[model samples]
Target chain A: MTNVDTILKDMIIIPKGIFFRGSNASPDEQPIKQILLSAFAIDKTPITNKQFRAFVEQGGYDDPTFWQPKGWAYIRENEIKYPNYWYDNHFNQDDHPVTGVSWWEAMAYAKFAGKTLPTEAQWEYACKGTDDRKYPWGNKEPTLAYANFAYDCDPTELVRSSTSVYDHPKYKSFFGCLDMAGNLAEWCLDNASTNYKWDRDGKDPIYITKDEDYHMVRGGCGLHNEDFLRCTARDYYPVSVRDNLIGFRCVVNNVKEEEL
Target chain B: MDILDLPQVEESRRMVCVCNWSIRRTWKGVRLATIIEKAGVSNTNNYFLKQISVGTKEKGVYESTIPLEDALSRNALLVHSVDGAPLPMEQGYPLRLFDFGLYGYKNVKGLSILEVTDIYELGEWERRAGYDKDGIIRPKKYWMVDLKGWGFAEKPGEMTDF
Candidate 1:
C-alpha cells in the first residue's frame, strides 16, 4: 500500500534562512526583506488530481513544443480545456489538489516530471522552515480545523481529507513537510515583480520587469487568509492565468538523477 | 443616505484594471444612481454589485461587481468620503463603490450587501481562482513588455485595437 506516488518520490532538502519576506498587512507588503535562501528541493504534496491526470494523458495538453511562448500564447488564447477542478466530478479523488494549473502549466508539469519549479528562494526556503514560520505551521492563527480554511466544511464538501495523508500529527513539518499550510496554492519560479530589499545590500533583488506577464504564486489556499497563508505570502497571476485555487508541486534537483 | 454619511471619491475615476492606473480624485457619495434608484431596479434586471467586509463569510467573498448599467450609472458613487477624509481602511473605509470605466478591482470594500442579480456573479478573485475574468486592459502594446533590459517600440501608424 505504498502509493502517495511511491511515498513522494525523493528530494526535500531546503536548508536555507533569513526569512521575513512581506505583508505586515500590506503597504504592498512593504519593505520587509532579508531573504538569503540557497539550498532547494521541494514538492511533498500538491500536484495531485491523480498526478495531473498523468500529464493530461501523456500529451501534456497537445504539446506546443512543451510550452513557453507566453505558455503557448496562454494555451492558444484560453481554450485551456482542463484542470481547474477538472470539470468537477470530484476529479477522480485520490486526495485532490491539482486545480487549473498554468504557471506555464506548472512548468509543463515540472518538465514532464523530470522536475523543476521551486525558486522564490526555493519556495521561501521550503515554507519558512528552520524556524522562520509565518506558517508551514507556526506563528499561529489559521483555524477552520487548523488548515483547509474558509469555514472548513458545509460548503457542500467538494474535496476534504487532511487528517491522514501521512499521519497528521498536526500535519507535520519542521522539515518533514505535509500539506504545507492548508492544501493548494503552490507554484513558484519567481517573477511577481521579484522584489528583494531584505536590507538592500548587493545581491538579492530580482523583481523581473520587462513586459511582465506574471509568475510568483506561493502557499496560501484552503481558501486563503491568515494574511494569505503567510510564509511571506505573495500572490500573482498572468503566467497565462488559470485558477480554482491554483495547484503545483515538483522540484527534484536530483536524487540519483534518472534524467531530470 | 446614511451608510455613515457616504461621500468620498477620486482615485481618478478609479480604474485600476489590475494596474493600468487612473486618477482623478475629489469625491464623496450617495450616487450609485442613488442606490439603484433606491433599490427599485427592474427593467428586466441585469445587476452585479458585491462589496463585503463587515465580517465576510466566504464562498469567494472579497467582493466587487457592477454592470446593471454600471450600477445605474449617474456616475455611480456609494463613496464615504476620501480626500475630505473619512474612508481609509487602506482606502475602502465604511463605504465604497465609485465607478467610471470601473476597474481597481471593481471599487469594492466594506459595504456589506448589495446582490441585485439577474445571473452572472463570480467575483472574489473570480470564483476563488482563475483571475483576469476580462479585467482586460490591452493597451500596453499587448504585453510582453520586455523582461529585463527594457526597450520601447510600436508607433508606426499604431492602431492595435484599443
Candidate 2:
C-alpha cells in the first residue's frame, strides 16, 4: 500500500503511444486524429494555490530571470498581483486546485518547480490513457459522479475534497494518475492554433496572436458540463485572462546522459 | 417583434465592433430607446461602457462594451432571434445585442448585465494586451496559400519557395 506521501509524488509516468484527440460532439472538434507522444511525466494533480503562494513568496514576480521576455511583458502590462480568484475563499485549502492562474503564471510555476508544462500532444496522451478512451475513465459519458462539474454546489466545494483527492474512485486514470479529466482546466505548453500542422510541429512553437493569446486550455473544469469533459475537448481563453475554473499541471522530461 | 422579454437595462445601449462584416439580420426585440426610457441614463458623454456577459459558469463572465451612439442606434436591438430562428449556442441564444455597423465581436453573446458608466473602458482582451479594438475586417485571400500538391520538401529552401 502506498503511503500518502508516496501517492502525492510529483511526476506521473505516461507511456508513449498514439491516442485519439478532440471531441466529435461539435464541428470545431471534428477530425479527431491519432497522436503519438514520447513517454513523459506529468503532474499528478493541478497546481495548488499554496504552491503558487510559495512561488510568489519567493519573489517570482520580481525576478526577471524566472520568466520569458514575453511573459515578463505580459506580467507588467496586466499588473497581475495574484491569481484572479486567489482572493476568493477557495484558496484557503492547501489541496484545492489553484485558479486565476494565467498560462504565463502556470508556466512560471512549472519553471520554478524545475519542470515544464506538457505540450498539447503530451497532455492528450496522458488524458486519453493507454486504451484511447474518450475521457480519462473511458468512452462512457461523464456524470457528476465521475468529475466535479456544473457548479453542483458552491464554487468552493472542491476545496473540501483536497484531502480526499485520491479517495474519489473516479479520480484514477488507467495509468494511475489522479484527476486527468476534470477538476480544473489545465494549461499545455503548446501555443493555441487551429491548424493541425501547427500542433504537430514541435519546433518553433507558435504563440497565439496578442488578440487570441487566450491559448489552449485542456481537460475539463468544475464549471464544465458533461459535454465539455471529453478527453479530447479543447478550450482556450486569453493567456493573461484568469478565472476560478482554470488551473494547471506540470510535466518534467527525464533526460538520460546521452540525450543531454 | 416582442420587445418586453429582452432584458432592457440601460447598459444594453452600447455595442462593440469586432470584424468588419456587420451583416444586419432582422432583430425584432427591445430597442435601446425603450431600455433607456426605463433604466434612465445617468451619464451621456460616457458613450463607452462595459458589458459583462454572464455564462452558466460564474467565472464564465465575458465583458465588453461599445460607443454610446453605437449603443443607442435604432439598428442596435436586444436581438432575440437570428433569421427568425432562436439563437443557437454558437449564436448567443436567448438574448444577444446586435449592432448594424460594428464588427461581430461588438455583438456580445450570453449577455447577463449591462452597466452604464462614463469611463472609456477597454474590454477584457483590450485591457490586457491592447488587442485590436477597431473591429475592422481586412480582406485576405486565404490563411493557407495553397493546399493542392502541398507535400514534403526535401530541401528547406524549396519549402520556402513553395
Each model's iRMS = 13.4, 12.9
Model 1 stretches astray by more than 4 angstroms = A1-38, A41-58, A62-101, A123-235, A238-260, B1-14, B20-30, B38-75, B78-117, B121-162
List the candidate 2 regions with Cα displacement exceeding 4 Å.
Answer: A1-9, A151-170, A195-212, A257-260, B1-64, B67-75, B78-120, B123-162
Candidate 2 CAPRI grade: incorrect
* Candidate 2 lDDT tens digits, B1-162: 345565543322212222101122334566765666567775556466556776767546677777766556534577666556676776677777665444456556877777776676666655533343533222211111123221222221101222
Q: Give the per-residue lDDT digits (tens) of candidate 2, residues A202-229.
A: 4323344553354677776665555556
How high is the DockQ of candidate 1?
0.08
lDDT of the structure predicted as candidate 1: 0.57
TM-score value, chain A, candidate 2: 0.80
- Using DockQ as the measure, the top candidate is 1
Lowest summed lDDT across 10 adjacent residues in model 1 chain B is found at B142-151
Q: Measured by TM-score, how close is model 2 to the native structure?
A: 0.63
Q: Candidate 1 lDDT, tens digit per residue, B28-118?
A: 7677665666667656256566555564455334765556664454366777776687878766778777554444565567767776666
